[model samples]
Target: MITVRPSGQRGYADHGWLRAKHSFSFADYYDPAEMGWGALRVINEDRVAPGTGFGRHGHRDMEIVTYILSGALEHQDSLGNGGVIRRGEVQRMTAGKGILHSEFNPSADEEVHLLQIWIEPAVHGTPASYEQQALPVDAMRGRWRLVASPDGADGSATIGQDARLSATVLSPGEALGYALAAGRLGYVHVVRGHLALNGIALAAGDGAKIGEETELHFAADDEAEILLFDLPPTH
Candidate 1:
């Protein structure tokens, strides 16, 4: 079964420095029926204004992944990890026990657009760690590129969960397909542009939840970027 969630139906918040759309409840946005999908907890698409960004914050027992869409974000963490994440880069932070981090837009004129994802870890109270990798454009041009997995398979950043995250960029007329194992759950998030999942159309910011579906197809109606997650059954 596939259920669609329209772009405009998501919760929206506009703070002068940050404009974010929450696919699942986060911060002050709350929706009882939209809590999450399987182990996928939060998908926050954020646009941070130039010269401003998120201050130091703490998280625990969560697998946090940051996907950069444009500009750059300077990250500093309590674990002594610091770096600048640019477009095409994926950052994974395992807030096992607890961790403090801050993301800032270092650009003076360009706003940074990114997606912050939070997943429930399969294990808890482990040591915190971080990993960052730049994904090659060719790898995702017309196919799903694994970005995060439990074991870091195919060079993807490792996560503390039994889930896989993949990203793709499709041009008009391009199509892709994926198959899920029995008893697995699937999720599709349209990062930008328009596309059709199976036969239903989805625009930027739209999302879909899948259950009992073994095969999934994506056809691009316009240039589009997307993120897909294969998750274990909810606990």
Candidate 2:
């Protein structure tokens, strides 16, 4: 079964300095029916104005991942981990027990556009951790590049759960296929351009949930960037 969630239907919050859209319930934008898909708790698309960003914030028992779509995001955490995540980079922070962090735009004039994701940890109170990796464009240009995984397979950043996240960049007429594990599920998020999942078309910011399907396919009408989540269904 495949269910679609259009971009326009997502929750929105525009605070002048921070414009965010929630794919699932988050920070005052609650929707009981759209709580989450599998262990994926949050997918927040955020645009931070130049010279501004999120101040010190706390999180616990969540595996947080940040993907920069454009511009750059400067991050500083209690663990003394500090760095600038530019386009083509993925950063993962495990807030086991608890952690305090801050994210801001590094530019004084260019806006910072990025996606913040939260996935439930398989085990609680493990320990706080952080990981960052640069994903070259050529790596995902025509295939699904594993960016995060439970076993850290394919040189992917390790996450705190039994899930795998893959990203792909495709040109017009390009396609990719994935054979689903018997009981695993898949979630596809279109990040750029237009694409067709199975047969239904999806544009940027759109998401699709697939469960119990034996196979999955994606095709792009033009240049497209997509993120795929392979996860064990959550109860």
Candidate 3:
């Protein structure tokens, strides 16, 4: 079964400095029926204004991952980790027991576009940790690049969950495929441009939930970027 999630239907929050779209409930946007998909808890698409961003906030027992699409995000956390996450970079933080962090756009004039994602930890109260990696365009061009996983395989940043995140960049007419095992579920998020997933059309910001499927296919109609989530059955 394939369920399409149009971008327009997602919850929205425009704080002037932070315009965010919630794929799954986060902050003040809540929907009982739209709680989450399996272990994937939150997917917040954010556009942070230049010179402003999120202040110190706390999180616990969560696998938090941040991806920068454009511009850059400066991060500081309770673990004393601080750095700038540039375009094509991925950052992961394991808030085992608890942790405080802040995200800010370092640019004084250019807005930063990014995604903030959260996954339920496979285990609780381990220890707080952080990791970051910069992916070159070659790594994602025309293929699924594993960016996050349970063990940080292939240099992917480790998460606290039994899930894998693969990212890819596609050009017009480019195609990609993945085998969807019978028991594991799938989620596809188009970051930008138009695409056809198994003949179903999807636009930027669109998402699809895959269940009981045998294969996953993607074709780009224009230059596009996407993230595919191989999710576990626990939410």
Candidate 4:
């Protein structure tokens, strides 16, 4: 079964400096039916104005991953990790025990566009950690690039959950296929342009939940970027 979450149907918040759309309950936005999918808890598409960002916040027992869609995002955490993640980089932070962090748009004039994702950890109360990896544009062009996985398979970033996350940037008419093992579920989020997932059209900011399906297909209608997750039934 496949359920589509329409772009215009998501919870929206415009805080002047920060405009965000949440696929799941976040901050002050709450929707019981849209709470989350499987082990994937949050998928927030955020656009931060220049010189503005999220202040230091606390998190625990969550495996957070950041994927910059455009521009850049400056990230700093209490674990002493700090850096800028650009369009081709993926950042993962495991707030096992606890951690405080902040994200900002450092540019003087360009807005920062990114996706902040949270997945439940395999085991709680571990130490906090951080890792970032560069995903060159050439490698992701027209194909799925494994960005996060439980075992860091295929050089992807490691996560504390039994999940695998992959992303891709596809040109018009390009396509990718994903096969799911029995009992495995999938979720897809479109970042830009458009796509047809098994004949279901999806535009930017749209999300889909998949279940009891053995295979899925993604074909880009235009230049499109998307994130795919393989997750357990629950966090």
Report the C-alpha lDDT of model 3 over 1-235, residue by residue, as the tens digit. 9999899989999999999999987789998877878888889999999999889999899999998889999999999999999887899999999999999999999999999999888899979999998777679999989989998898898997889999999999999999876788899989999999999999999999888887988999999999999988642
Q: Rate the local accuracy (lDDT) of all candidates.
A: 0.94, 0.92, 0.91, 0.91
- Per-residue C-alpha lDDT of model 4 across residues 1-235, encoded as one tens digit per residue: 9999998888899999999999999989999998889888999989999999989999999999998879999899998999999988899999999999999899999999889999988899989999999877779887889999999888788999889998888999999998988899899999899999999999999999999998999999999988899997652
Candidate 1 residue 180 Cα shift, in angstroms, is: 0.6
Model 1 compared with the native: what TM-score?
0.98
lDDT of 2 at 128: 95
Give per-residue CA lDDT, model 2, range 118-217, as digits (tens): 9999999989999998877689999989989998888788998999999999999999898889889888889999989999999999999889896998
All candidates: CA RMSD in angstroms? 0.8, 0.8, 1.1, 1.2
lDDT, model 1, position 214: 95
lDDT of 2 at 124: 93
Candidate 2 residue 218 Cα shift, in angstroms, is: 0.6
Per-residue accuracy of model 1 over 65-157 as CA lDDT, tens digit each: 999989899999999999999987899999999999999999999999999999999999999999999887678999889999999999999
Model 4: weakest 10-residue lDDT segment is 226-235
Worst 10 residues of 2 by lDDT: 130-139
How does each model score on TM-score? 0.98, 0.98, 0.97, 0.96
Off by over 4 Å in 1: none
> What is the alpha-carbon lDDT for the whole of candidate 4?
0.91
What global local distance difference test value does model 2 have?
Answer: 0.92
Deviation from truth (RMSD, Å), model 4: 1.2
